[model samples]
Target: MSAARWQRLVDDLAAAGVESSVLDKPYTESVYGCVHHGVSRSITMLHPVSGIISISDRQWSKNPDVWVGWQVFREGRDSIVIRTWPITKKRSDVVAHVLEAFNTEDRT
Candidate 1:
C-alpha cells in the first residue's frame, strides 16, 4: 500500500530539479528498514562536506509523525541523523527546507 504523501514528496523532489536517482531512494542503512525493522523510504543527495544527505521518515510511534526530513550521512561512518521537526507543507516548501538545510553549514 503506497501512500499519496510519499509519492507527492517524490514528485516535489523531481519537480524541484533534484535528480531522479536521489529523489526516490539512495544507498542508506535505514533504507533497508533498520529503524522500524520494517519497510521505509529514503532519498539521498550528495553533500559537499558530509558526503551524503538523506531525507527519511519517522518510525517509532506516530504522535510526532513526520513525512520527510533531512538526515546526516557520512561516508564510511555508521550514520548520524540530524533532527526532525514538524513537517507538513507544500512540495515547494518542503523542498526548500531540505535544500536550505543541506546548504547550511554548522560552524559550531
Candidate 2:
C-alpha cells in the first residue's frame, strides 16, 4: 500500500511538472513523543530552486494526534509545515498543497 501511495504521489507531482524523487528506505521521524515513518529523500522543487518534503505516516500517541503531514524545507531554511487530519485525505489534496507551496515560493 505504501509503495502504491508513494508511486501515485510521484506520478501526481510529475503530472504537475514538479521534479521529485523518492527513496526506497523509510525515513524515521521522532516528534511529539511519537516516532513517525516517512519516505526518505523526497526532494522536491519547493521553489524554482529546490527543497525537501517529507510525506509522514500517521502516528498515534497518548498526547495527541500527530498524524500524516507535510514538512517542506527550502534550501535548508526554516520548514513550512502543512498538517492534515485523518491521514485519509485524497492524494490530490497533497498535490494541491505542494502546488500551493510551490506557487507561494515562486512569488517570493
Candidate 3:
C-alpha cells in the first residue's frame, strides 16, 4: 500500500481508539498494521498477501505473532485484510482481537 493509504488506515484506527502507527526508516513498510494488545503486551501485524495477522514481528521485539483468530491467512484460505479493504465493511474484523481481549479480561 502507498503511504497515503497507510496514513488513512492509521487514522481510521485512531478514530476507533486503537493506538497504531506506520513503521518508517530502516523498518520502512509498503503496508503495515502494528496493533498492540495491552493485556498481552504484544503487537501483531496484518499480512500483506492474506490479511491474516501474523505473530509479532521479532524485528520489533520478542512478542509472539498470532497464527489464527477472527482473521488469519492459511494455505487454502484467503484472509480479509482490513487496511486494504473498505473501512465500514471490515470494521468488525479489524477490531476483533481488541474486543476479544476486553471480553476475556472481564471474565477473568
Instruction: Give the runs in model 3 whose Cα sits over 4 Å from its true position.
Output: 25-92, 96-108
Q: Model 2, 33-95: lDDT tens per residue? A: 889775543434535554434454444555434435443333323444433223444677777
Tens digits of per-residue lDDT, candidate 1, 4-107, equal 66677778778876653434333334433554333456666766565455556654345334333433332322344454334444557667766665665533
List the pairs of residues colliding in candidate 1: none
- In candidate 1, which residue ranges exceed 4 Å CA deviation? 1-4, 20-38, 59-85, 106-108
Q: Is candidate 2 or candidate 3 better by TM-score?
A: 2
Better of 2 and 3 by lDDT: 2
Instruction: Please tell me which predicted candidate would have the highest TM-score against the true structure.
Output: 2
Clashing pairs in 2: none
Model 2 ranges off by over 4 Å: 26-43, 49-54, 62-88, 106-108
Worst 10 residues of 1 by lDDT: 69-78
- How many residue pairs clash per model? 0, 0, 4
Measured with C-alpha atoms, the lDDT of residue 23 in candidate 2 is: 63
Please estimate how well model 2 matches the true structure, expressed as its whole-model Cα lDDT.
Answer: 0.55
- Candidates sorted by lDDT, descending order? 2, 1, 3
* TM-score to true structure, per model: 0.51, 0.53, 0.31
Residue pair clashes in candidate 3: 55-65, 55-66, 56-64, 56-65
TM-score of 3: 0.31
Clashes of 3: 4
Candidates ranked by TM-score, best first?
2, 1, 3
